[model samples]
Target: MISGRRQKKLGVRTLDIAKRLLDYGFHPPTIYFPLNVEECMMIEPTETESKETLDEFIEAMIQIAKEAEENPEIVQEAPHTTVVKRLDETKAARKPVLRYRKREAQKQ
Candidate 1:
């Protein structure tokens, strides 16, 4: 269980870190809330993951931590390699878009 804490007034968002994990070919753990903990990352490794995979995940986390320390911006703005970037959670929650709507050109 990794709990991220804000340091020196620099905001460290657990959500951002989780999103960054996607860039590393790993799924982020469930974070924050429920436990009333701040920036909590609950890591539960399944038997399916091989030793190599676990090693890679550890490496990615170490790299992310380093980035957070040196260049916090990188960690702050994550998922740079994904097909879609960040989302507007507030807007999405307020106005949910469940289904996809194809463009007129695509309908042709």
Candidate 2:
């Protein structure tokens, strides 16, 4: 288990990185745990993972880092490729969308 700290100077939170990873076809590491550490990302690569997979993850991370510096907005508003865009977690918590709606029926 290796935990890496985010660069506060980049003005990007661990959540942002995690979300952005989805766009890169990867899941983001666990973030903001071990309360003692600020802006922490914990990655535990299992033995089942191949070197090629790890290499790809590293490349994606490097790209994200560059994006964080070059265009923070891209990193801030991540997972652009996902079916659902970013959600307002605070608002969702306050007013949860409990029921599922069929899109076709709604269109009718």
Write the residue-wise lDDT of candidate 2 on 19-90 in tens digits: 999999987788887667777778888999999999999999899888988898998998899999999989
lDDT score of model 2?
0.83
TM-score winner among the candidates? 1
> Which stretches of candidate 1 lie above 4 Å from their native place?
6-9, 100-108
- Residue 48, candidate 2: C-alpha displacement in angstroms: 0.5
10 residues in a row with least lDDT, candidate 2: 1-10
lDDT of 1 by residue, 1-108 (tens): 887775224675888789889999898888885477767889889999899999999999888888888888887888888999988889989998898899999999
Residue 82's lDDT in candidate 2: 97
- Residue 103's lDDT within candidate 2 is 100
> Candidate 2: which stretches are off by over 4 Å?
1-6, 100-108
TM-score for each candidate, following the candidate numbering: 0.83, 0.82
TM-score of 2: 0.82
